[model samples]
Target: MQIIIVGCGKVGSTLAEQLSREDNDVTVLDINGQRVEQLVNELDIMGYIGSGISFDTLMEAGVKKADLLIAVTGSDELNLMCCLIAKKAGDCLTIARVRNPEYSRETEFLKKELGLAMVINPELTAAGEAARVLRLPTAISVEVFAKGKVEVLKFRIKPDSPLCRMEIQEIGPKLKSDILVCVVERGGEIIIPNGTFVLQERDNVYVAGAQKKRRNFLSVSASAPDR
Candidate 1:
């Protein structure tokens, strides 16, 4: 995909590098000449020095031929303007990073009004994920899907925990809970465990199931007395 990214701060440069690595033709625009030059040399992608809201700069960055344009400028308003112009000029899919909490609440309105393909609020997303993890403190990390009806959790096995030396097949019967053990990370190696696979101490286990069921399983398993 031919991609144009506006802004050269940490997020913009990192996005350029990753997209370029994925074989996308990425062109970045930033008013900072040093930033533009540095990313151009480091990532071997095109860079333009100009304001992203300028139509001339968008054209110079090949926005007309771009498959996608991502605007992540420091200012929410500037990012929105860049996407608006890119959509008008290129008719390409557009994404904008809108961080201001006030603007964040009107994401749907902004997307509909601006013809945006996506409105990315990184701060809001990070906060939501952090809240999910905090809600399930027993898990090392937590990811929710299906509107929080389902969840995937990762937790490490400690020596005295009931799950430390348990077999995958025993969890449902022993713990009286139904959950899918998806992946296990043990000693720097990843394993897709089978029914008979035994879990060991320090192994990082990933489980997925209905949110309530998974939460119950974690609570019951966590209640086992330490030896």
Candidate 2:
């Protein structure tokens, strides 16, 4: 896909580098010439040095032919304006980062009018992630998808747990509920397990299933012995 990104900050530059590495045609725009030079040297993407809200700059970045346009400048106004211009001028899929609390609340209304595909709130996203960890410290992480009905649950085996040395197949017969442990993490590698997989102490498990089934599944772990 051809993508154009506005701003050259840490997040924007990182996004550019990843897209470029995937062999996507990418172009990055920034107001500062020095930042543009830095992006050119650090990423394989083309760099345009000018205000992203300007038509000339966006045109030079090849926004007209872009499949995606992302505006992530520090200024909310700049991001919104760039997205609006990209939609009006290029009809591309546009995503803008707007941190103002008010804009976030009215995303539905604004998205319809502005032709925006998404609005990202980095702080709010981080806060929600932290809250999930606080609720399930025994699990390294949790992710909900399929409109919050399907879930991905991560758990670490305590060295002293009775099932620490058991094979994955033994859990179905030993446990009272239904849950599928889809992946395992040993050291830093992620493993897709088969029936022969044996879980060791400190092994991280990634389970996926329906939300209610998965919630009840976690209750059987050593962390919930009192339940």
Per-model CA lDDT versus the true structure: 0.90, 0.83
**Worst 10-residue stretch by lDDT in candidate 1?**
218-227
Writing each residue's lDDT as its tens digit, candidate 1 over 1-227 gives 99999999999988999999999999999999999999999999899999999999899899889999999989999999999999999879999999999998898999999999999988888998889877777888887778567778988887777887899999999999999999999999999999999999888888998777888888876832222
> What residue pairs are clashing in model 2?
none
Best by lDDT: 1
How much does candidate 2 score in TM-score?
0.80
| Predicted structure with the largest TM-score when compared to the true one | 1
Give per-residue CA lDDT, model 2, range 32-130, as digits (tens): 889889889877568888998999889888988999999989998899999999898897999999889998899888789999999888887888788
